[model samples]
Target: MMRKLRNILLTLLLLAIVALTAGSFFLLNHALRPADNKGRDTEGSYAYMFQTYPFLRPWVDSLRRAGALCDTFITSADGTRLHALYARATRPTRRSAVIVHGYKDCAVRMLMIGYLYHHDLGFNILLPDLYGAGQSGGDYIRMGWLDRYDVIRWTCVADELFGPEATIAVHGISMGAATTMMVAGEKQRADVRCFVEDCGYTSVWDEFAKELRAQYGLPEMPLLYTTSMLCRARYGWDFLQASSLAQVAASELPIFFIHGEADDYVPTEMVHPLYEAKRRGGRELWIAPGSAHALSYHDHRAEYTARVRAFVRRYM
Candidate 1:
């Protein structure tokens, strides 16, 4: 009986080891892969995910028409065709703004800002659906690496359409905001003036830390650190290097950091450090009193647009 029990214990141990390994592999794969709310493998799946998610659908159809939108397609460096939208000033305008949509959001969400600039302020607005999110091509999200490259292509298109000397500004919200900050960190020769980042996170690792704590009810640092390392090992992406906090701190360009006071997703504290770091770099930090992530504009419309316009007018 003792011998039989010993054999059963060993068998259970082996099975447990296999299960643990498979679970680790699955977790790491999800952490590394681009999160497509729209499933990548099927068009029908994409449509279903979009429609089922009420938070995102109405913006695509309603917001597109409200801005008098025009669509364009640009190929990425790897030959992926990206769908972009433009809401140009009805009359001539020298200032241009390129708006990037956040994770799970399409370019049309930026049309509210475009309407403000193009209609009210006569600034040409450009909005691109980032890779794996909307009509843009590509399967890997790469957090912000592949994204920054796409933004570079969009910048090239913007420069070509508007003259090289045209005043250019980039605006981003949440993931889009993080992408904008990362792209600004890159070397650009054009007179790229100001960046507007709303509810942007400090780093990929930090963002995932919040997710870990919220979902697993665990402390962030050690588990997140280990999972991030596993993510790098399994997927060849270094979350440590995927930090906009480091990038923005080192850049010469001026930035405007906007955050919602009641935000729990990215947290309001993330921007405080970024603000302190950018104190000497012509940066402005605005915190809306009672807004959530990406709702700063909706809560404080006049203040939000005024801050955005004033920042552009001052720097660009």
Candidate 2:
């Protein structure tokens, strides 16, 4: 009787694992697939974004009118044609700023940052559409793992455009921020002096696990690990290995970390540990009060700009 009971328990355990694996696959492929962002296509999405900063469109218009805007393309190492928008600085400074946008975001959405860098900060700006997003060609969204390599390419592109003496600083929002951290870890060109990451999660696995728990009220254990395996098999990358904490801990680049205190999307708690993990000499962090995910600039532009400017002055 005891032997039969053990056999039944083993069968139930195997069935449970099978069910979790199937369910996790369905959830990840359907929910987190590299689909176009519905929010960006609608004017409602930009209403708050555009309206909050009235000068954003005018700055873009002025840049275009002045013939400073250059829409360019670069082919990735894998032959994917990547798109980026470059704007020359008014003051002819060799300093370059490469802006990386978040998931499902295009290069055009980064014009506000371009304006800040080119017009106010006296630095040239390049905004790239990440692989598998916008005009860039790819089948999978790398969630900042592979995007880090693309950033290295962009750094080389910046050097090619502005010459080798150009100084570079990468600034990214959300997924872009995570990519910047990953890039900081990689041994790349010396032009990449510093990085600014706003509201970035710790890792692909951690973020997905948090999402699973929050959205579906599901435990991560078998489901998340199973999804990681699926991602490895299908996407050629594992979510578990794409860790920003490990990357940042391995780098010596100066990093300015910013996050909204009220940010539940990426969670404010994640940044503290990330900032604490800094092995580099230069690191700064700010938690904007009353702000939500990626909205620190929207809530407090002056403070954001000031802190960023100070960071640039000190590091970049």
Top TM-score model:
2
Cα-based TM-score, every candidate:
0.82, 0.91
Candidate 2 on 97-169: residue-level lDDT in tens? Answer: 9998887676766666776688778998888888876667776578899889988898888888877789899
Candidate 2 TM-score, C-alpha based:
0.91
Clash statistics: count for each candidate:
0, 0
Residues 1-316, candidate 1, lDDT per residue (tens digit)? 9999999999999997676566556655565554555423335533653654444355445546676467789887668888887765667766888888776666755656666676557887788888775677766565665588788778777776667777788889998888888887788656577888999989887887787778778776555566666667755666777888887877678899999999999899999987777744589889999999888987787888788888889977
State the weakest 10-residue window (summed lDDT) of model 2: 38-47
**Which residue ranges in model 2 land beyond 4 Å of their true spot?**
1-18, 34-36, 39-52
Write down the lDDT that model 1 would get. Answer: 0.75
For the record, the alpha-carbon RMSD of candidate 1 to the native fold, in angstroms, is 5.0
Model 2 global lDDT (CA atoms, 0 to 1): 0.82
